[model samples]
Target: MNITLPGKAATLMASQRERAEKQRARLGVEARSWYRISNAASDDEAEVMIYDEVGGWFGCTADDMIAELRQITAPRMRVRINSPGGSVFEGIAIANALRAHPASVTVQVDAVAASIASVIAMAGDRIEMAPNSMLMIHDASGLCMGNAADMEEMAELLDLISDNIADAYAARAGGTREQWRERMRAETWYLPEDAVENGLADEAVQAPKAGNAPPAPEEDDEPDMARAWDLAAYGYQGPRRDEPKTEEQQPLTINIGAAVGEDFVEQLRALVRQEVKDRTVAPASDATPTGPVAETEPVEPAPEPAAVPEPEVPAAEPVDAWAADIAGLLTTPADDWAADLTHLIGPDTSSRAAAEA
Candidate 1:
């Protein structure tokens, strides 16, 4: 049945769809099969993948899926879904077919089951969702091309469809039809655990190991393809990929003594000492000249002066014995000065010398 949206909403959706079509065209994206069927672990078991939209836009229609299912003679069928949903009627038909199948049906939500796709999931005897997967429920919506009467009729039809869909949810999850309708109207999204807690899924399960998996199609090789769909156009604002995580860097450590030998360290210290001594001794070398230098006149010879008698030197003040000893020690060679000073003073002098060195 044709679904309907409000005038403004329908117009916006049409514009968005137009833009998406242009973008897909620019990207050279061609329509291809959105599902695959293959044998499972056992000969009597089969797996069906509905990994895109539900209808022909970028996926298979109900007739296509049902026909494929008819060919499987397995006693058990595993239906895996990862879709943003498509034609509501198509999805409902597929779901009904799965329910009518003689095989024990198991539904696995690989990533997402939104809109009509969630209805398709309800047909499973056992529904399992991947840990990071999601399920969404929303009121039926579509476009109608006509005047006020046609719009009104379309709106009424959409409400009926939505009510039926809500009833399907209520049947599975044990809620009142009206309660489910409220949630659908709000576009409820459920994470794996939430889906289980709300009875939408039986359990959240771990994905099968790669070793036990069947070879995937080349188109599905890129994991991001699931997240790459334009779910935004459907007003889905659920989880999505962010930037990839980078490996944490290890902390750095340095062993100075091991990196540079003791000899090298000593040499460095000696160079530092020499630098400090030079800076201390010639601090004025870095000063800027303040003014121009005056010209020097030639020195004139001084006239000889009469000699005067030298006054007798006053008796030298008696020097303290310790002062004499210190004076003598000051004359020692620079290499022995530390030792001499330590001898004159005490252990503290030796410590001071070592520290200065």
Candidate 2:
């Protein structure tokens, strides 16, 4: 299923995944949460102590237990458990392997059988609990991030998981699936007596050697009153954890440019038209007179239009000089009329006349 989570919710899911990975690592052999397999002195029964959480070791699994059983080939086997439960998947697998083994299996709860650990306890051919031990069962839980639809799907998935757990419990405990589900919902804690009374165990037994028992958590303080839905879902609530507060959503703001529309375009066109009209309008000083100017008492006469002068004709060149020059040219004739004309005209005409000559 696709899920679009907000940034904060995504970060929260990532942090939770990292924490689970770290826990899985810490529950390994290096952290001393191993399954110690040994044989009884007479070698009649194989003894296995599950001192750690389910699926706690990285290098070992249900296959390892089955492998151990294969090595012994004993007619009987003893499984001891003291765990707060870790991986439900691994626990269920181990339970099935034990139930299917050739040997008659005897399951002894040392300290606690909570979550999937309780489910594993039910695989015993004859279940026994220590006097001071406890057992708890509850619905399966998981982490998810998504929208409302995704959340609804997750809820349905959890219900399905819870049904599977109830089925496992009902197989050995002799109860209706619904009844077991109700007990799981309540996070029912069962003391050894309570477990026997509820048909969850066959009988009570003496506590194992002090050295073999599961150690109490260090704090040993009173339970915290805080609500722990996640841990409670898994049937393991030690000290309550405070729920982290979510950050508030800030208001979203955006700036968009002026909206475009036909009306806006019309308004823009009108504005451009107005600007063109303003520039095209003649100035008041150059405008034609529309009416007489307002006057009080004296009125100044309007100035006349400036007169345009007529073009002047050049006076006729003096007839006496022309006549004298003509008479001189006629009297000074040399070989031809062209020489007389050149002498009458001047040096420039004389040069042209000589070139022509």
**Clashing residue pairs, backbone N/CA/C < 3 A, model 2:** none
lDDT, candidate 1, 25-88, per-residue tens: 6656454667788866579889998988776454345676789889888999999999898778
Instruction: Output the TM-score of candidate 1.
Output: 0.50
Tens-place lDDT per residue, model 2, 85-201, is 766666777888888888899999989988888988999999999889999998888666768887777778778778888988788778788999999998999999889998899
Best TM-score goes to which candidate?
Answer: 1
The list of candidate 2 runs beyond 4 A from truth reads 1-31, 57-59, 206-357
Which predicted model would earn the best lDDT?
1
